[model samples]
Target: MTAREVTKADKAEPGSPEWLKLVTASKIPSILGISRFKSQFALWHEMAGNVPSEPISESRQDDFDYGHAVELAAAEYWRYKNDGWVISRGEVQYTDDALEFGNAATIDGRASRGAWRRIVEIKTARDLEEWGDDGSGEVPADYAAQVIWQQLITGWHEPANIVLWPQYGKPKIYSIEYDAQIAASILTLVREWNASLASGIPPELDDSITTYETVRRLHPEIDGREVQLDAALAHDYLTAVTDDKEITKRLRGLKTRVLDAMGNAQTAVVVDLKIATRSPARGDAIALRSNTKADPATIEGISA
Candidate 1:
């Protein structure tokens, strides 16, 4: 189904199965680094039309955790600001909610003016263990990109603050300033992704290998198996291969061809294709062969 059709039933009414399904589907993708689940939530919020600024407790755990983190951070800000620091709380419109945007993309939490003047996006990081002793307090590039994209969607001026609460220590606040150029570039990329998804075609993979690795690590069951690549892959690939154009092109072509073949096959027949990188004397070649129980004659006829 088209992204539009897939999202048609995504209205955010409390207790609705459609809403619940959207939340559930997003969980796997978000965890698997397949797509930004937050973006999907944001899109759902926009589609649902001005939902009340209350917490949706029945949402996914990861989402709920993020929301709680933001609220706690906001409360902390209130406490600190009340003591003399200038702090403000943005209205929590949809905590881990779904939002649809202009028939293009979906977003996660959609916050606007309520408690604070600007829109707030809350991201949680377990710890800064990855960054050893860089006192500069560097934020991970991926997390930074996420906040910038949210800024582009919400049109917020101030940099979105990332509340980094480690499991072992106190939370560290990281400020993410909005970069117009960067935000614009992200929007452009997202638009292209929307177009491809609408056509039932997956977007070109810029970092297929890295994404494959991430998916494999997160969902062991789906690893080494063929599955539909979604927006999350597109997003990660774009970020992963931002500098390598050649690999990106090849990966995109391979993904498209594979998806197209699968789309045409009969579901009852259960067609399976094994893709492996072969190092031939000439160069690298991808070998595609069926790995199913269907007879050779049937397979040949189907291919023909």
Candidate 2:
């Protein structure tokens, strides 16, 4: 196997771990549809070397590794089909050693049939229902963006996104063509993000929950470190909190009234809609046997 040269995007501080470094592929999602995110580009800036990034959780990493392995197996299965000018399992380079041009992409497979050439991206999905089979062969937006990114970098005229849905009979393959305008716009957005990182000034945060969580994580409350807000800000905050409390009280009252009125009826009819008041039936859990052996270590911990 030929050694892949590391690009500037893949490089990190001499002693820094790989997770802290921003990967080129991670930025592709931001360019999927819009050129904006909840945390502006601050999260991505952190990802791309501006600041440290949170390491992926072990369980999530395990899922990723498993998915990758499945994808690779699928890629290897079709690698032998490049009969003519088609190069199967081609090594796609995002950038040369100088890292002047191109971004990174690992195309699952590349194949050609006569005058046609395509870059194949294999995906393992939990279910096939995510794909549309109404003769449109529609794929989710993020996956579409990724294939388009591959097309942009690999220069593949048409990129094919093959989804392996195990429950389904065969794999669903969607061949996608490039939009020159979209490509140009995405490149511009990438440059904008790069500029934001270089300037050390992040863009405004969005109203996403992830952004809120990230903000909390970045600046947790320090004990006895309270600052008074101005009248206008205080008014807005109090108004929001008070309104939320009133609305929640009203909702709880309505729900309690409905539950009290429900009596023996499992379902309640509100005009034309049916609201279920009954809980779902659950299976009985297994009972522990008294005959089971107990460990002395468990007793010591229980006592503590």
Candidate 3:
């Protein structure tokens, strides 16, 4: 069944095999490719309010393998619990797929008769080297954003723990906290993105969209230049451009101008360009942006 079809069933109901089938199948499209599927999966997991599971694939069974590892880890965790372990393999419903709005909670076991605690999210890596040395693991920024989203949806007040199980090493756990403001912003962005995708239009890339390499390559003068633009800067830029047409045209023009300037020069030249913005505080700011040096004569000609 298609993703839309599979997502039509109620996902919160327990003891319903159809719900399980639907939940499992809805993730098929996301698991088949490595594109932005991972980000989408993270978002879905957060929305569902359950520990994120790997997408099931027949050829590799990575999801099942990781799930089994988590089962072992959970078992190990229970050994420390003063109360007897009340763990079940797959028993909780985190969300209702039929309805767009829902909480993130486990569909599985309880630690005790009166306490229904959710299992922490599990992520498996091939080795310890795969994780960052800081012990936080190399969780993607987007994935962290999703985790926050999950917390908001589930209304869980406590910080969430993410377990990272390396294939050849002992498991490492990272704690993450939810940010309500960030989650709200992300939800707004996701809604806009989904609407654009549904309308068969891809999202446009703006100045904030250009990666470090792309920016350096396109504007050689910016090469080795250290300038940090935080989320606030990016969010302001994105939100300012309400018209897609205007954004596309402006970016295309800017790209053409930068390329033309770079191509004509043979030596490195620093150019001071005026960046126009709608912000009241910074009205039109003129920043001295540098580029590679081209021949002085050639540069003069372009400037002339």
Candidate 4:
């Protein structure tokens, strides 16, 4: 149940350029979040060609419904650009000789207006404001890295990102110029990723609860079973528990300090940030904001 696409190159050979492109180019950029801790699993999956079928979750369905609209937005952008200069759009695979991986890339479209020549990546985001600086041409860090790989493949240093909002009629265009050093750093990280896969070693988990969730999903806890950890690992786990207790105490102290500072005040101003106290029953709690569209699972009346 791999999402890997079939191509005419598959009939030719395994290590052929087309085969390389098939593996690299057709990758959906949204899933390739290099910044995410779980992304290492994607790299591992690619190297091993062992992609487990991801269940069609609600979020995934929403993404699919919006994906085509983004493509159409890209197509329209190309149409407007073509009115001014020469640009090409098609399914093309590019391989870079300089990169260590030298993986192929299949770009959505290529465009040039005046002296500016760049590859275009189309996207649809539910929230557009998070991209940052409004007009400073800031894209998500993961997307920046993804486009950098595309640039490496296309032998193009510049990329124009067209991100459309489902609620808005106009698209926000980001003209990005990636630094070669940054791209090199990302490439090094990717090489290490592949090497880890080759060695059958999983990357160290970072601060992502999603990675933990993924592990739990794949292998649920077994009751009445004891798996032994190495001596050092077991010691580390014990140390972590001790540290967690200390951290919890310190966090409580910090919270108390903040609450005391706001004492009986409905609104507390912390420089540019606003901290508001909300009354729920007999207690007052800090007004919190959630990043997701849904209510917090920890909050009352909200379920997972």
Candidate 5:
């Protein structure tokens, strides 16, 4: 990719009208079905302009704010640890010069060493369990996809590094090597997604909670009505519910057995691996309650 073939969109705030029109790096994980927070169906609907963008809850907004606040700190740490590396923290967005399929990226930071340039993505995590050892290239699939998408948009195939700030430790870096095959596959997927948008057909639904919530939001009315159901779907639902009850009962029995073996111990272990740890519920424990509503239904009927 050449500079002449790449166009920059200045100051395109996320969720703005201009940003919504383009498939940014952050959306790649959703499209690839690896995003922990978003489902492909939700992304498809939003990109198709069929529904309003999902609102950010207060807790989610706090997460974003924390990430934005420490972005510079993460970048600075990266520079401090890696000698001779210069980092640029700028709000720059990029797309193809031809604007093909409207793919875009707003990189968190850019790094350069002499003539070699690399994309630097900053992330904050509550824990590093989901992340791999530093420089292992074993980051979460969603985050890895985000970096690859950034590289694709920036036309920089040089390996990009993810600078992560964990809750309790100094930052760590994960390096992702560029794979042309993966980039091509992602590009094809992006093109197909755009084609689906143009065709006015949303992506098929998955069994993700995000997808289920999106469906619920799309149809929020609880009207006094009854509708026919497909036989197969009804039978499957019944079977799933029955299995869920049996599984829950078995799980409880197993937990009781494990606790009996542990007997006043706080930690459960097997050989060298830690299986589970029991800790007293504190801070916000009283407030942390399930939001799931009871299913108001009989075998013959259903309601929200």
Candidate 6:
């Protein structure tokens, strides 16, 4: 089954309650475990409504607004560069009824040259090395998944393009072709995730920070009660703590030994590899004084 365009009256705004009901393109990478920023467990809780998303900080909100501004500018630049292409800006929403788990996409813009029209996804990056030559279609896996998900929802057989604006270089565009196999796999994963959502189960826990944050939000307050935990779990935790302490002590000794060996040198290198480098001390270290009490006044010469 293919996706259909959403109507204005029915379309929901981004991050709105209605939008949260459907899996979005931006979230596809996380569900597939390809996202660098978010984990599947975290996404599961979000989709299951087990925990609300963390509030965006003002600086983060500013970054988002700046990125959107960049996107608008990039779209306009792309249009100007390609005189023959017809470009339409703003978000276009789509919903796929073919899949049991509802899927949706909000593409950045559309570009049409002659009879070829494709989805346009704009991105901003500080690292230019992550991108490939223009039109090479080599982008970060998470971003590729995002565009592919967009294609899947839009049912666009033509290759989609990602317009990336780097911090220092001119914008580069990568063309991403449709992959039926990957799209099918994504569909399977989404369906399974939807089933988990319906069953009131979440994805298996992970060690990601996002997972920790989600868990914390799941239990915001303590009841001041203790519950007996599994013996093995307690043992494992204690063993890890012991191991960490020992490792930390050993690491400090090793660092001191290395520093002693270096003598006056600052860096330790082995065959072009800089194994260790000491940073110059910035300023006098502040001595910590306990607030509870001050050290007993030092006796000049009469101390016993």
Among the numbered candidates, top TM-score falls to 5
Question: Which parts of model 1 are misplaced by more than 4 Å?
Answer: 1-70, 77-91, 94-116, 119-121, 131-136, 204-304
Candidate numbers, best TM-score first, in rank order: 5, 6, 2, 4, 3, 1
Q: How does candidate 5 fare on TM-score?
A: 0.81
TM-score for all models, in order of appearance: 0.41, 0.60, 0.43, 0.59, 0.81, 0.75
List residue ranges in candidate 6 displaced over 4 A: 80-83, 129-137, 239-304
CA lDDT of each prediction against the hidden true structure = 0.44, 0.55, 0.44, 0.55, 0.75, 0.77
Model 5 alpha-carbon drift over 4 Å, by segment? 1-9, 133-137, 249-267, 277-304
| Deviation (Å) of 282 in candidate 6 | 18
Worst 10 residues of 1 by lDDT: 273-282
Off by over 4 Å in 4: 1-37, 41-46, 49-53, 78-83, 86-93, 97-102, 112-117, 133-137, 164-166, 217-224, 228-304
Per-candidate total of colliding backbone pairs: 24, 2, 16, 0, 0, 0
Which candidate gets the maximum lDDT versus the true structure? 6
Q: Give per-residue CA lDDT, model 4, range 11-80, as digits (tens).
A: 4243343342232533424234545334555434434544443456897787766775567666676567
Task: Please give, for residues 33-86, the per-residue lDDT of candidate 3 as tens digits.
Answer: 222333343423322333323344684676666676676665456435435545
- What are the per-residue Cα lDDT tens digits for candidate 1 across 1-304? 1222223344454434344333222232322233532333333332233222235555566666666756656556534533433333433222222344232222333333444433333444432333332223676656666666545544455656655555445555567788999766655655544454455453233334433443343344534666577989788878777757878898678766665665534222334533322212225643333333335465564552
Question: On residues 1-304, what C-alpha lDDT tens digit does candidate 6 reach at each position?
Answer: 4678788898877666666778898889898988889999988887777777767899889889989899888998778766888777776788878766666788888777777767988998754435542334468899989888888887777888788887666888777889999988988888887888899888888889988888898999989999999999999999999999999999778777777766767555444334455543429532221112222333233223
Task: Give one digit per residue, the lDDT tens place, for model 2 in 95-121.
Answer: 323233334666556566776757776
Model 6, CA-based lDDT: 0.77
Location of the lowest summed lDDT over 10 successive residues in candidate 3: 273-282
TM-score for candidate 6, please give it: 0.75
